[model samples]
Target: MAIITVMVFILIGIFELTPLIKKGDIKGFAINLALLLCSCTVLTLKSLQISVPSPLKPIENLIKAIIE
Candidate 1:
């Protein structure tokens, strides 16, 4: 999961940062890539636990309450 998230972020970063990278701003590119990778890793780790609440569950409950 963590690896998948990092890969996704890296791909997105490459696409979005191409302009800055092409203009010789290697530092900005590196920093953004590092940040993206770190964020994805953290989020993936957080998602690994089985007991975490599903984000949609609350919304579903609210809708059910309204319907009933």
Candidate 2:
């Protein structure tokens, strides 16, 4: 799960940064850098097995209910 989270963050960071880098927008580049840092922090938390409640768990249960 931690690997999955890291991969997702990396993909998102690349997606966000690519356009900014292409446009030569330094501010956007910095913002994306900050986002990358935050994502890394999250990845580190996951690596440490710091469990937390799933933010989407309730939504998932709702979907399951509808499906059932």
Candidate 3:
């Protein structure tokens, strides 16, 4: 599963990121790569049966704190 996830992301990078890189859009390439890597890591971990904290947890906590 992890391998599959990585393969998919690699394909995405090759196809999607190639154009951005060729265009010399460093900022766009960096941002896209960062987001892709983050998502890829999370997906890979999940595939490996690792527990990943929900992103909404912090926002929920912040809302509770504000209400209090």
Candidate 4:
């Protein structure tokens, strides 16, 4: 399951990067690769039954404090 999940992400990353590579857009490729790596890591961890924390909690608390 983990391997399959990672492979899918790898394929998606390849498809995403091919166009950027063809256009010689190094910046775009780098940004996309970073995002792909982050998402892939998160998804892979989830597949392995790891708990992921929500980064939005702090932001949500800040917003609530400002509003209230």
Which candidate should be chosen as best, given lDDT against the real structure?
A: 3
What lDDT is reached at residue 41 by model 4? 91
The C-alpha stretches of model 1 lying farther than 4 A from their native spots are 1-8, 50-68
Rank all candidate structures by their lDDT, best first, as comma-separated numbers: 3, 4, 2, 1
My TM-score estimates for the predictions, one after another, are 0.51, 0.58, 0.89, 0.80
Can you give the lDDT of residue 26 in candidate 1?
87
lDDT of 1 at 20: 76
Per-residue C-alpha lDDT of model 2 across residues 24-56, encoded as one tens digit per residue: 998989987897887687676877788756779
lDDT of 4 by residue, 4-58 (tens): 9899988998889999999999999999999989998998899999988899999
Estimate, for each residue in 13-48, the C-alpha lDDT of model 3 and write its tens digit: 999999998999999999999999999999999999
Q: Give the C-alpha lDDT of model 3.
A: 0.98
List per-prediction Cα lDDT, in the order shown: 0.78, 0.83, 0.98, 0.93
Clashing pairs in 4: none
**Stretch of 10 with least lDDT, candidate 2:** 39-48
Once superposed on the true structure, which residue ranges of model 2 sit more than 4 Å away at CA?
A: 51-68
lDDT, candidate 4, equals: 0.93
Clashes of 2: 0
Regions of model 4 farther than 4 Å from truth: 60-68
lDDT of 2: 0.83
* Inter-residue clash pairs, candidate 1: none
Report the C-alpha lDDT of model 1 over 1-68, residue by residue, as the tens digit: 75677678778887978987899898987888778867776677776753545679999999999999
